[model samples]
Target: MSATAAERQFDELASLYEDVAPWPFRRDIEVPSVLHSLGDLTRSDVLDFGCGAGLSSRLLAGRGARRVVGHDASEGMLSAARQREAKEQRGIEYVSRLTPELEQRFDLVLAVCVLPYASTRSELRQMCASMARVLRPGGRLLALPLHPDHAPDPDYYAPYGLRLVSDTPHAEGGALRVELRAAGVEADVTAWYWSRNSIEEALRDAGFGPVFWADPWPPGLARVEDAPPALHAYLRRPHAAMLDCRRARVSG
Candidate 1:
């Protein structure tokens, strides 16, 4: 499969992404929130868009999803994911693009950190449309995009081993340089920022029903006040936001 400029960039970071599984933010905040948002997966067919090293794909399979298909544009990332699938034999099908047979085939689509990579509003809409295209009429999509209200301070997320820097923090489609660091490992990636209105408009135009932004709260905590002091700030200003919405069901 041919790679886009963004995909090629991810190809170089494939190894670093593997190490991301152990990052405190991913382990303690992001993953937990994502899993919580995706409540039961039994007998469900899921599409892991931007599967990236198959981390979330494996998690879905392990959670009892009947079938899991991982789709990605970066061959390097897919290679790492395929290698793990070969060893684990988890029955996941990894593909670079959706085929005719796969259209409207999934019950749910999980797009982790995928939408923010869209550098343009058109690209963002196309990404959302693709997710909608693969889902059954009433199927749902769970996505994580850069939080529209993230703190402007580049070092705000340094405690979580992440740093986001942008020349125009308020620009609707500004470039964001993301740095990930942990335990002697470091990687840099580029993403774009879109406001809540822009994101929701794209979803609606893509045939999705009402969009919901879920809080990325740590699991086992009833409220943000219940979180430890160290987590209060991050919880208030997470780097990414969770979005959930369903494809508009067919009308009679």
Candidate 2:
């Protein structure tokens, strides 16, 4: 997708995004659990990349982050976040710019459902690098993405989305209306399913020491009927199945 188109796509989604996404929004999980597992963030500066409507950021604030900043590429989303912030009387700093005006060095960075919208690997890398650049040595990152191991392929490009064999609303024959990316969006725009080695390699390449991995199938969203056995067993086997990793201390 062209830069302009990419911007417009999110702008449109921001218009009625909240209404269509209420249930999952209410069920959001990875954010808090990941934070808690990392221990106290009360005195740490935090950054929420792809902050979306700032729902997760608000959660961080309630958890008592020293200072929180959210950055996204969509102005409409930022506006929505601003509205929410004003309504709740919270003090999150939301910016539409991809890179926030931050040099204070964050102790933690939280990203959920980011990377999917990235049109290319480079964009994803840039975002990762941006986080590494801003984080203090030893800081941790908790990232969540929609393209769970069994993601419903977006745009039918990558062929990784959940394939239903039963039935559901948006889906009639196969598994269910769980997923089927429209032609409008490119497969590349969706977060490519990064395998364990790839993520480790990418993180190390970006200067982040590998900590661990988490929820291959986060219950944050509805379950896909045809999710592989490995996916189901992992999510249900133990809530702590996901990875919890950290970077080494700064050497400089």
Candidate 3:
């Protein structure tokens, strides 16, 4: 599998990613919403698709997943993941791609902050297809793709150490080039913006059932206490969208 532009970008940033990703943002803002989407995973075989630095992979393993595997296209990211695995000894497996051997293996797959790097419709569809192939019958896929509406307001992402340098419109939706400053280093990352209809269509093409979009903050869950007051409103608007999809159960 050739490295995608997005994968290469992540590989370059892998070293600095963990340092800037605050626990408060992960536990308070991201995890809570993801957990609400995933009711329980006590014994499920989970796949952390595009598991950058294996953060979510560890999260799954810690949450009692029976088997947790992380797949990424970037060796730089995988290297970080391996280091964490060695330190934590969580027994999680880390691989480079969704190989054919993994077909119909996982009960739940989380591909957060992935997919948006597709940069093209074909790539988007192909990514979704890979997710479909890895899923067991009736398995669920939790997709966190770039939201169509991103950084609507000026200085929207500054509080999070990200600056929206450009938002260029495209046929698919748009391209967002963000300058992320973290750990005393800065990098520019470009992500493809996929529209809701396009994402849903891709999921259907990948043999998934109807796609369900989740609100950024589900009802009953309060805002992250540590989140900056300036970011609260933008968080409510969603820089990324959560999609819930399920593979069809094979009939006997």
Candidate 4:
């Protein structure tokens, strides 16, 4: 399959991207938040839309999802994911394309850091449509996209081992340079900025119902007041936001 610009970039950064799994913010905040929002995966079939190294895909399988299919355009990332599946035998399937038989076959689509790869409004709508096509009616989509209200300061997320810089931070379809750093490993990727209104419109036009912006909270923490200083600060201005929406059920 031909690679998109984002896919090619990730193909080169595959190893470093896998290294990001253990980073504090991702391990402590992002993963748990997304998983919690996805409660009770038992017997569910899930699509991990941007399943780099199959991190979330493995998690879904461990959580008792009957089947997990990871789809990505980066062969480099898929190679790493397949190696893990070979060893662990988690029964997770990784592919570069979604076939006809897979259409409307999943109960959920877990799209971590996938939507912002769309550099245009049309691309964003197409991405949403792809997720919608693979989901059964009333199935859910859980995504993490760049927060429209994210702090523009390049250093704002430095404490979390992430940096986002944009010469045109407020402009729709503007490029955002994202840098991830941890344990002496660093990688950079490009994502586009889309306003919250634009995102909601795309989802709705793709046959999804109302969108819900869910707040991220650490798994073990009962309240935000209980979080430590650094965690609290990151939570207050997270660079990405969790979006939950469902496909509209067909009216008979």
Q: Please, what is the TM-score per model? A: 0.96, 0.67, 0.90, 0.96
Off by over 4 Å in 1: none
Clashing pairs in 4: none
Instruction: Tell how far residue 138 is off in model 3, in angstroms.
Output: 0.9
Quote the positional error of residue 172 for candidate 2 in Å: 28
Q: Which ten residues in a row have the lowest lDDT in candidate 2?
A: 168-177
lDDT of 1 at 216: 83
Q: Write the per-residue lDDT of candidate 4 for residues 1-252, one digit (tens) a residue.
A: 356786678886767877888877788889888888889999799999989888889999999998999999888899999999999999999999888889999999999999899878988998899999999999999999988889999988888888899987868889989988768888789999999999999999999999999667767897766876668878888888999999999999
Q: Estimate the overall C-alpha local distance difference test score of candidate 2.
A: 0.56
Model 3 ranges off by over 4 Å: 23-25, 167-173, 182-185, 218-231
Residue 34's C-alpha lDDT in candidate 1? 88
Candidate 2 per-residue C-alpha lDDT over 28-98 given as tens digits, one digit per residue, 9 for 90 to 100:
33343465565677898888987777877887898899988997777778888998888988789987654
**Pairs of colliding residues, candidate 1:** none
